[model samples]
Target chain A: MPVHPGEIPKPNTAWIWKTFWIITAITALEFAIAFVMPSSTLRNSIFIILTIFKAFFIVAEFMHLKHETKGLIWTILIPMGLLIWLLVALITEGNAIHEAIF
Target chain B: MSTISPTTQAISDSALDKPRTGTWDGGNEPFNASYGKLMMWFFLLSDAFTFAAFLTTYGLIRHRYQPYTGTPEAFEFSTAYWPIPEKVFNAFPGLHGFDLPLAFVALMTMILIFSSVTMVLAVEAGQRFDKKDVQKWLLWTILFGVIFVSCQAWEWSHFITGTDEGTLMNDGTRFFGANLAVNQYGPVLFADLFFFITGFHGTHVFSGICLLIYCFIATTNGTFEKRGHYEMVEKIGLYWHFVDLVWVFVFTFFYLV
Candidate 1:
């Protein structure tokens, strides 16, 4: 694609280290919140949100998905979207079962 | 066979020599990526679904119980409430008395992330056709990976060894450590997910290490040089990064949250 076959375009290496530091910082922040925050729905939700934020950086930056073609990006992400449905449905079912029993 | 005209014969011959434009997905490489690269993405995508299913089931089973809110001192393994993960995972290796919980797991997360960084650096070196650099970074990546797996082994062993105090079951017997049938933890299901999810991820990390060793050997053998590219490194890097990505989630769901 870079005027010859098998040619990989050289991207900035700085980006890699940058992403690493960002991830490390985010992880440190997660640790800080975990130690201080009381166990509550809001705290758990924040953890999940931060986890997603970390995931975005990994998928989009480290995996190079953001720089890829739109079609390619969609191909990878669209199928993953269905996982939300499975999670939601199963969680509801699990909660129901718990109520039924106790 | 001799019935074809000369002009028609020329057209057919050229067609055989060169594929017509726009024939394969509007002419350009599909998604502007190679067949192997595209396939890797799809494979990772499927693999993501598999991990998602496992973790989603964990979430489902976890939500079945009311959350544990007991103080650290009051905590004990029982089916009446879920055990706070930190309390269960508190003991650090070597030091017996330290009630450190998420500290070691956090270290594992950092190690895995650092290895991923090394792997991406290898990919960058590969793109630059710097085989020596590629090999160097790859060795680092593999080293970190092995270290990560070793740390996990320790973590799993510590988990299996459990606490010296152990837990007294409702029955007269005492429960120590965990296995398929018995878990000293709150619910048997928690230990099941712990072993299954973390074990599966560990297996992936091991596989990625093996793949890196292969790449290292190939780089030494001038394999990528002969092929005029180093896309293989990129492919394996994708896999290594995915392993790290999965760990990110596992750390949150299993340990932190």
Candidate 2:
């Protein structure tokens, strides 16, 4: 194929492998924490935070979203704010329903 | 196509007459990404919301019950209480009868993470125009995806079959596994959400595998070479990464949490 100067992504193999290790380590940390820390609200919250951290890497490094323009990045992220609202609002309603049932 | 520079192809001839500062006015590649790639990103964002809706529903349903407050060792599966994830997904292949909570799903997570790594490598190779490496990485990615789906199938079967220590229900019959009707582990909704959520993600993985196969075959036959770019491979890579990303959330909410 002739080189016509297509958008060439930064072809850094080291970063890919580095990302793999970082993701794997976070998952390993998650699994270890599960065994030692008994199930509780705090433990579940920690799990959610770690999961978000891992998600950032998968999107940023693997999907190449990090290198995308900030405009593009915010374009995707800003709407997620509404999703957070959805989670909070519905979960609270669910708790109210639970109070009625029990 | 080969004669025209990528920049020329990206921006139309009329746009060249206009000022570069007026990005929105004409075709000055503002994001520096192709139209196809941008569409894929938008599509994935919509798909993310779909998954979010499913998960949010699960959270709402889960909160409707009083979560079992007992210690993990003393916990008993019942319809009256929310099930602990580790208590439900404990069995591992060839190592049954042992309580290795969260272990098997962890292995599944590792497999998915590795597959994402292979996907990015394929994208890298595509950018470099290394035909052989692109094909190699795509094949590896497809292989891992198949393995991941197979693991999910096995996990589903284990979930449906349940264990010998089935929970005794209110009626006196011992319910063993899970189905649309009842899960011995917890409320019927627990089993319902598990099937709906994980099954949906599994379908995405299955479709991703099919897309990868087509992408792989296209790469081998020199389709991309003639087209002068491997943007198709890059787009598919984005889809594959999104699948892996969804699994990360699924793993957190369904298994470890």
Identify the runs in model 1 with alpha carbons over 4 angstroms from their true place: A1-12, B1-22, B25-27
Tens digits of per-residue lDDT for model 2, A35-60: 88887889999999999999999999
Candidate 2 interface RMSD, angstroms, 1 decimal: 2.5
Least accurate stretch of 10 residues (summed lDDT) in model 2 chain A? A1-10
C-alpha displacement of B23 in model 2, angstroms?
Answer: 6.3
The positional error of residue B27 in candidate 2, measured at the CA in angstroms, is 2.6
Q: What's the DockQ for every one of the candidates?
A: 0.52, 0.61
Q: What is the fnat of candidate 2?
A: 0.79
| B139-211: candidate 1 lDDT, tens digit per residue | 9999999999999999899888777777888896888898877878878888889999999999999999999
Compute each candidate's TM-score over C-alphas.
0.91, 0.91
Clashing pairs in 2: none
